[model samples]
Target chain A: MTAPALKLKSTALNSIHRKLGGRMVEFGGWDMPVQYPAGTVEEHVRTRTHAGLFDVSHMGEIDVRGLDAVAFVNGLVSNDASKLVDGQAQYSALTTPEGTVIDDLLVYRFAEDHLLLVVNAGTTDKDWDWISSHRENEDIELRNVSADYCQIAFQGPDALGILQKLTRLPLSEIKYYHFREGEVDGVPAIVSRTGYTGEDGFEVYASPDKAERLWNKSLDAGNFGADDGVLACGLAARNTLRLEAGMCLYGHEIDETTTLLEANLGWITKLNKGYFIGRDRLLKQKEEGIGRKLLGFEVTDRGIARDGQDVLIDGQRVGQVTSGSPAPFLKKNIGMAYVPVEFANEGRAIEIDVRGRRVGAQIVPLPFYKRPKQ
Target chain B: MANVPENLHYSKDHEWVRVEGDTAVIGITDHAQDQLGDVVYVELPRAGDEFVANESFGSVESVKAVSEIFTPVSGKVAEANDSLTDEPEKVNKDPYGDGWMIKIKMSSSGEVDSLLTAAEYEDFTKAENE
Candidate 1:
C-alpha cells in the first residue's frame, strides 16, 4: 500500500508526467511515476538499447562548503574523499561508528572547498540529521539543497549523443564519474557523465523551475516519438536497470546491520586512508572473516523471487533475498541475496522460497547484465 | 478502455468465466492484463485440485509484481493451460482466446448466475478505474 496523494511531495515535472499518461505512485513519500504507457519491461529494454529519460529530482542533494569540506566528508563517509579533484564523483556510504550503512550516496567534489552529496530520497531527512549532528571542530557549512535542483537521468547507449546537442561544453571531454558545468538548452546545468543503468549516460542537474524545458528539449533532440527512440522512464524501469547492473539499493542490499565488507564494496572502502567512521569495526571484520556475503543468482525454476523471501539450501533457510526482478535485457529471473560465506561461490546451488514453493536457483556472478566494452 | 466479451461472465476480482455445461473455462480479464503490463509467468492449479468460491487458485507474474488470480466459482480442476509454462506472454497477446488458464468441473452451477455479465462488468471496471 502507498500513502495518500495529499501527503506526498511532487517534483517540478509532475504535471508533464500526468499529461504523458504516467502511472503515478508514492515512492519515498513523493508522488512519482512508477511507469509510463511504454510499460516497465519495454522501458527497461529501451534504456539498454536506445535512451531513457528519468526524473530523479527526488534524490536528495546537500552542499558542503568550507576549507575542510573534503576532510569533513572523508571523516564521515567510507570513501577516501581526499583523493577527489574537481569534477569527480564517487559512490560512498555513510556508516555508523560500528560499521553499518546509514545510507549510500554519491559524493561529487566541485573543488577542495565545495562538494555535493546526492542521497536517497527516503533517507534524506535522516541523513541530514546524521550529518548535522556530527559537526564538531569542523569549519564546514552544510546546506540541504535538494529542492533547488531537478536531476534528470538520461541513460542508455545513445544518451550521450542526444544530450550533446543541447550544449557545447565538449561532452566528450567529461570522463566517466566526472561532470562539467554549462548550459543545456540555454539553461545553466551540471552535466554529469554518470548513471545507474549499465549503459553510458549523463545526469543533468539544473534548476527545479527549468525542469520542464530541459525535459522537452532532450526529447525533441532525440526524436522521442519514433521507434527505437528515447523513452520517458519512471522509477520501476530505473530499479530494474540498477538491479541488472549489480548496483545495490539502500534498505535492500545494505541496511544499518549490513557491513561494507559483507556487501562486497571493498573497492570503495578506503581502509588505508585513516581513521574514519566504522574503520575499527571494518578492521576487526577484516581480521575475523565475515559471516555472510552478498551474491547474485538466477531463478532456474519458472518463477520470480521477490525481496524478503527466504533463500534455502537443502530445504533449510540460509539467507534472504534482497532485490529480485526480471532482468528484461538479459531475459532471466535474477536477484541478490545474503548467503553464508561458504556458499557464496559463483556456481553454488540455492533455492528461493517463491511464495510457498521452493524455486530452484544457482549462485552466479555479480552482474547479470553488463554493457559491451568499447 | 478494455475489451469486454459479451459471451463471457466476469467476477468482481477481474477473472472471466465462460460456462459450458458442467465445465467452466477461466482466464483473467483484459483489464487485469492491461493493468499488469507484460506477463512473464502464470501459475495455475493442477488437474483434479479442488477450490471453493473466491479461492485463489493461481497467480500471474508481471515483470515487477505477482498478483493472485482468484476463482469466482470453484470446483475440481479438469484441465490447465500447461503451455503457459514456456509461453507466458500469450496471456497478454490473447488473454481470452489462447490464454485461457483452466477448466473446472463446477460443483454448483448456480454460482454462474452470481457473476456479472459483460455489460455489468464494463460498468464495474469503469467505476473501479475512476
Candidate 2:
C-alpha cells in the first residue's frame, strides 16, 4: 500500500509487534497491528474464551481540574455530568450547537472536582482544540495528557485474575465503568473496569515508561494458558469484539452529522438535567422519534456483509451497513446498519445486498454474542 | 506456523492443488491461513461448479476481513471439503493437511504449470513485505 497522507503513529509496543510478525496497517492515522502470527480468528477466539492483550496507547486522554470543573464540563457535553460520583465513568457525546456529534467520549470523575476524558485517537487534536478554544476562565484547566499515558487492555474471563496478581489494590472493588488510581509494579496507574469487549476485563493506564513492563508482567503471569495465557491482539479483533459487545464506534456509528437518537444512544441523553450544548436538539428528538435509526443484523446467508452494503427490506433498499464482520463468537456474519425506524425492531427479517445478490438476514438486537457467564 | 507439504502444487493465492488421478485436491496454503487470521465462516462452492482461472471459487471470513479464495486453474469442482463445516479453523491450524477446499477435474492441465512454485510464492511475499 502507498504511504498514507498522514503519518501513521505507533504505540509503545510497535517494536514488540514487529518482532511478533504482526501485519501492520494504517488505521485512523495510527500504524497499528492488523493481525499477529496467530491470525485474527485465533486472537479473537482467545479474547472471547480466554484473554487477549491490546495496546490502546493511541487513544487520547484529557484531564480537567479545578473547582468549577464539574460545572464547566456539564455545559459542554450531552450527558448529565453532575450525577457522576467520584471514581465513576459515563459515556457522553460532545456535540455542535445544532446537535451533530463532535465525538463520543468517556468521562471519569477522578476526584470531587477533577475529571478525565478519554477521546478517540484520530479526533484527539480536534477535540483538544475544541475544548481549549471554548475555555473562558481559569476555573477549569484542560490538560492533554495523551502523550504521557499508555494503556494496556486485558480482556476476557481471565483478565481480572491476571490483573489482580500485579496490583496490590483490590481489583474486585472497581465496579463496571469505574476506575481507581493506584500503584502497579511500583508505577502509578489507573485501573478501570471498562472494556470494549463484553467480558470481565480491565483497562490499565500507566505511564509510557512502564507500559512494556506492565504488559510483559501480565503476559508472564500465564493468564490466557496451555500455550500462553494472553495473546497480543490487533485492531482487527478489537473492532470485532466491540461490535459483538454492541459498542458503537465514533465515526461509523455516530458522527457530526448524526444525533444520539439516530445513533441509538438515547439512553445517555438526559432532558431533566442541567443544560448542555445539544440539550435542546436532543429534547426535540425525544418529543419526536428519530426518522432513521441504527439497528443490528445477522447475515443468515453465506456472504459476509461489509460497510456501505445496502440493506433491503422487501426488495427495496432501506439502509446501509456502518460496520459489518464475521462475528467470531457467533460464528456468523453480523453487523450494524442504519435503517428506517419502522424496520429497526429486533427480530425483524431483512435482506442485505452483498455484491449483487440479496442475502437473507434478520434484524437482531445488538451484541449478537455475549460471553458465556463466568 | 502451518504445514506446507512438498508434494502439492501451490499458487500465489496460497492454494495447494494436489493431483489425484483425474482430479486435483485444492486447499488453502499455510501462508493464506496466517494472513486470514481467525476463520469464523467459509463459503464453499457447490459440487459441479465451474470456475474460471483466477476467479473467486469461494470466500473465507476472519474476524477482521473477508477474502475471496480464487481458483488456480479453470476446472469443475468435484467435491468440497466437508470437514470445514464444523472445523473451519483447520485451515489456520493445518492448511495443507486437512483444510483442502475441493477436488476439481482440470479443464486444462497447462494452467497448473503457470501457477507459482513454492519457492516463487515465498519470494513473492518476501518482496511484498514492508
Candidate 3:
C-alpha cells in the first residue's frame, strides 16, 4: 500500500485568497497562493509602481520574554540583539555550531525582557527545537505564538498612503525597522514598517480571528480600480520581488551546508560581538577567507538561468544558481549563484547552463533593482 | 474557460496548428498562455529547420516558468514569428493571431489527422486541470 500524502496547512486568509482567484500551490507545507488573476508580472509591477497586499500569515512568530531575554536571545543568533531598542527590529539569522545557517529571521525587541522572533514558516518547528535545546536552564521563556496571529504585508511606494486610511495612528512615526501598536479596521494589530520587497511598506500582525477584516479593509482602502491601486500579490511575485532586491531566501541562499560568510551575510555575522553559536568557525573563516561567495548576475544572453543550473567558467562548473527569474521591473533576466571567490568580481564573464545550452552572463552588483528615492 | 478555435488542431502539449494548404501556422493555445502567466521571452527554431512530430522546437518563458513548445506534426520550418523575439507579450495578448510562433511546410499532411481536435483538446485540458 502507498503512503497517503501529507495534508498542507492553510493560513487565516486561505478562503479569501481563493475568492480573489488566487492560484494556490504548496509552499513550505502550507497551501499558499502563487499568483492571482492579475498574474505574477502584473502583481510584481504593481508592487513596484503602486501597492500590493500580501498574505504572509504562513510565517512563524516566536515570543521570547523574561528577565534574561536580551542576553539569552543574543547568544542564540549571530547579530547583536543587544543593539535593538524598544519597538525596533533587526534582521538576523540562527546558525549551527559549524557557522552554517539554520534560518534567516527577524528579531523584534519590544522591550529588554520582551522580544518577538519572526521566522520562516517551514523552519518553525526546527527553529523551536534548536532554541529549546540551547536554553540549558536559562531564565528566558519561549512560546510559539505563530498559530495565534496572522500577518499581512502592504508594500509599494503608495503603501503608506493606502494603509494610513485604515488606522488613525501617525504611520510616518514608525520609521523603517520600527513598529507600533494600532487598530487596523478597528482590530488591534502590531504594524511594522518593514517588508521583503524593495519598497516602502508596512507589515500588520493581528489576531487570527480578525485577519479577514483587516485584509478586506486594506484592499477597500486601496481602491482596486485605480491604475496605481492595490493588488493581491502571491508567492510568485514575492519571489521575484525579493530576488530583484537581492535578498536571500533561506533554503536557496543559506542552508545547513552554507555559512553566513559565503552567503555574503558577513555584515550580520558579528564575529567580535563576544562568543555565540558558530562564532569560532565564522572568525576562522573570516581570517582564512571564504572559499566561495554568492554573486548576483544578469543573463547577457537569451534564456533564464533557473535554480540549480550550473555556473560555468570556460566550460568548467564552478557553482550553481541559487535563485533566478526575469526581473519584471528591470526587464532583464537576473539570478544569484555561489561561485568561487576569484570569479565573484563585478563584470566578470560567466556562463549559465540553462537547460543543455550555455548562456552568457556577467557578474553584476547585488540588488539587480533598487527603488528610487522618495 | 480558454479560447479553443474549432478550426485549429491542437497537441496535448498545448500547441495549436492552423493549416493553410501545405503551410501550417503554429502557436500555443490560450489555456497555455493563461497557465504561463505573463510571457517575457520566446525561443523559436530557425527557419528551414526540420522537426519531427512531438519534437520540442522552441520554448516560451514567462515570469514564472519556461514551457517547451512541441510540433504537432513533422514539418520543415518556413517562417518563425520574429515579432515575438522582441515583444513576447504578443503571445499572451493574441496567441492565435500575431503571436503565432512559426509557419511550417508539412512533411505529410496526413499527420494532422492524428492530432487532437479543439473539442478533444478542451476536454483534455479540463480533465488535466481537475
Cα displacement (Å) at residue A215, model 1:
0.9
In CAPRI terms, where does candidate 2 land?
Answer: acceptable
Per-candidate DockQ vs. reference:
0.51, 0.45, 0.46
lDDT of 2 by residue, A216-318 (tens): 8988774445454788888888998888888899889889888988887878877688788888888888788788999899998767888889999988998
Model 2: fnat (fraction of native contacts): 0.59
Clashing pairs in 2: A39-B37, A40-B37, A40-B38, A41-B37, A41-B38, A223-A229, A224-A229, B14-B29
CAPRI band for model 1: medium
**Which sections of candidate 1 miss by over 4 Å?**
A1-6
- Model 3 bad stretches (over 4 Å): A1-4
Rank candidates, lDDT, best first.
3, 1, 2
Q: Model 1, residue B93: displacement in angstroms?
A: 2.5
Q: B1-130 in candidate 2: lDDT tens per residue?
A: 3455667777777788888877778888877777677676777889999998888988887767778888888889999987887788888777777877888898888888887776777676666553
Candidate 3 chain A, run of 10 with poorest lDDT: A1-10
lDDT of 1 at B116: 97
CA lDDT of every candidate: 0.92, 0.84, 0.93
Scored by TM against the true chain B, the candidates give 0.98, 0.91, 0.98
2 versus 3: better lDDT goes to: 3
- The fnat scores of all predictions, in order, read 0.50, 0.59, 0.59
Clashing pairs in 3: none
Q: Number of the top candidate by lDDT?
A: 3
